[model samples]
Target: MRAGPLVVVGDTLLDVDLQGTSQRLAPDAPVPVVDLAAERPRPGGAGLAAVQAARLRTSRETVLVTPLADTDDPDALKLLELLEAQGVRVVRLPLSGRTVRKTRLIAHGRPLVRVDRGDGRLHGRTGLPDAAAAAVRGAGAVLVSDYGRGTAAHPVLRALLEELPGEVPLVWDPHPRGAEPVPRARLVTPNREEARTLAATARTARSGGYAQAATDAAALRARWRATGVSVTMGEHGALLCTGDQPPVLVPAPPVPGRPDTCGAGDCLSAAATGALAEGALLTEALEQGVHHASVFVAGGPAPRGSDTAEAEPWDLVRRTRLQGGTVVATGGCFDLLHPGHVSLLHQAARLGDLLVVCLNSDASVRALKGPGRPVMGQADRARVLSALGCVDAVMVFDEETPTALLERLRPDLWVKGGDYGPLELPEASLVRGHGGQVLLLPYLEGRSTTRLVQRAHSEGGEER
Candidate 1:
């Protein structure tokens, strides 16, 4: 599904985290000293919401508006860099107060002490309201992430909502401490405790029983005049309440084992906003949100991790060597099947004992060419490639560049057509990076698929 443009407004903070291991007790004090391994900073608050929005709206544009201090906070800069890398547009409003920073010390995968600095307020900021309203006006939907740091409050949120088109959806993640004068929002996402607080009821009565939780969710939705309400119940999944529709229970996908449950809520809110922007019903959006949260809880490619622990290219190399096969690799769009393609496949097969053709998926082809191109579908192309006796395996990639896939495959030899320049091949650097050699095969000059298609079109002939 295609993603749509989303505008995210909320509190912006910096997360400074320290990671280390605890060794023998310190002699000076009766406390365990953690040997610092590394310290890192990431985007938190509204910046974090923007980052999450970028991930969900892969196709659509994302704009984030938040306040930052001119004091040159390294953590704030890192967050900006990350948002820029994800192609998210950011508008920074300068503030006189220091940028909020939350520093957490983690020992053996557990959080120790969390120190917070800076008051979470706009603090006599100029032009921020106008800039934020402009951002909201340009979006299909707006998401407000209220970390209770004071970025998302009455006046700012009311201004933002008024600026948006009436049909445009508004989603809010409310904070308990500052729930007064709730902004008019289409959807409100709150955890069980937050929902109880918003409803001004006992936390245990609201969350202790399933029936009570459902009652609380409905009451809160009605009180806030929201069209939809989603209460995220960690481990148990989420409960959704919508106007005129039966309440839907979205069960969390099974997490294989114990997991570090950080960033799950952020992921959920991002996915839900994306799904809603795509015109999905509330239930469908809730399901998609749960799915996204499950992936993060399962330790997927999250911002918190240093590097993804994927199988190294050498591992695949060793496995292929053990099978006593010479691995052959080739790549192309393979849009239309023709005699030249058949001939090239045979030639590539002869160069090695086994041939693996990497076929670009439909999305990849569309990215390379325009949307009107890719005359054939990915499945058909894969079927044709696999049917050829010269081809052993067919793999598909959805990236415009196959550098990541090539780095993973690490074939013994990489082959390409003579038509492409040595440097033009997408996998050229990757092949050479791991000491693999690249070879160019001779092309049948006249037997081109483009020429064949042109001839057929001119002659009023169809080849299928």
Candidate 2:
């Protein structure tokens, strides 16, 4: 939502991933032995939705409002730090006792076991006594990500139902263990199984299919007084139901190779919430949610990592181009990443909808800078640059100039650091011929990569 901030209220959690290979069965137990090789930790539940929503919004601000379980809770502290590092504004409620933590052990790229700990304990329901109601009242859109933790029960539920402004759109990812969302919610999204369980809870009996799913969604919509409900039917797609309207079928886009859809639902909820915040209508938001979920599941299957965002640039670039979004391209040896490079990237990103950094391939860098010039390999450079929030995509080009890649991409904007004048740019004519504007961003003084490299060499000699 570009209009105003998106406020998320729900239980926050920490998700940890233990990845390794398992070949043999354990002697002591029936479970397989998982040889842990890597560990990754990330924000989960509402915290995850906040990050997803923030990324989807691109230019809009997102605020996560939740209560920490305890002051000394390691997960809680880590969650705060992670959110802060990702540029999300967090308004934590009064601390209760413990933050929820979920640890998953995976072997051979599949999860073997999951261990969950901590209680979703928020101190009180006084509408998040500190930052809850205030944020809800001022939010452009609000999302309730109930994870069956104690936080989304009666008190906090009522506070949210009462405090959130009437005009704000609300999307709830309902959990049976949690209290029902307000009837005024724009949409209540539940998976097919959850929808079936909810239907049985409502004492309604029928079959389970796309047809039955619509009926079930309608029943829940009526029960909760919500305007609509959509049941996500995995690969079968999603069934949407609004008051007296026919069920709209949103097909799931195909994902290549093995599908990792663990967080697809969360991505849908986050995308829908952002669209609603941006004032999208019910049908539009639902469709947008489905499309985003497809994109997410295609790239993002891991639970505790942003590996999905590091997908092939071609796919993302084509998608952005198809959407009629502005595409900006810039290139560099990127031998050493410094604040000046980051500044130029940030500014380039602001000039367009998507920023693509055409990194120099290993051979290209070696050709341009001589031997021992590139301190890192092409892959390492691409990985480091891809980690930046401003750089949407990174691709390595083998050519000395990015003219060929720019010609293929036909970028709407070609951005260069201020160090280069218009005539000094080798690819300026090609970009201009393609009707692309060549913009030179100011380079920060005393931030040259060559200077940094020379200084390091001089220092090493001094020590010798």
By TM-score, the best candidate is 2
- Best prediction by lDDT: 2
Per-candidate RMSD vs. true structure?
11.0, 16.1
In order, the Cα lDDT scores of the candidates are: 0.71, 0.77
Total backbone collisions for each predicted model: 1, 2
lDDT of 1 by residue, 1-464 (tens): 22336888777788776877786799999877988877767677677777777766356788887766653666567767877876678876555467778889876656778899876465553345566667776778777887775666646555657566556777887788654424457678888777776776655533555665677778888888787888888888998888666677899865532455666777788778878888877788888888778755654324422221221223223324433457778888888887778878889888775577878889999888778557889889987876676775667778987777788777778988888898688678789888878998888788766676577678885634
Colliding pairs, model 1: 11-46
Whole-model lDDT, model 1: 0.71
Candidate 2 lDDT by residue in tens digits, 1-464 = 33567878887889897877777998999878877777878788888888788777356678988777555777788999888776679987775667778999876556778999886566765545546666767778888888876556747556666666667788899987787887688889999988888877443355676667877888899898888898998776688898896888888765433454667788788888888877788778878888778766644422323433444456566545533568899989887899899999999999887888988889998888888778888888987887676887787788888778888888889998999888789888888898989999998989988898889888897452
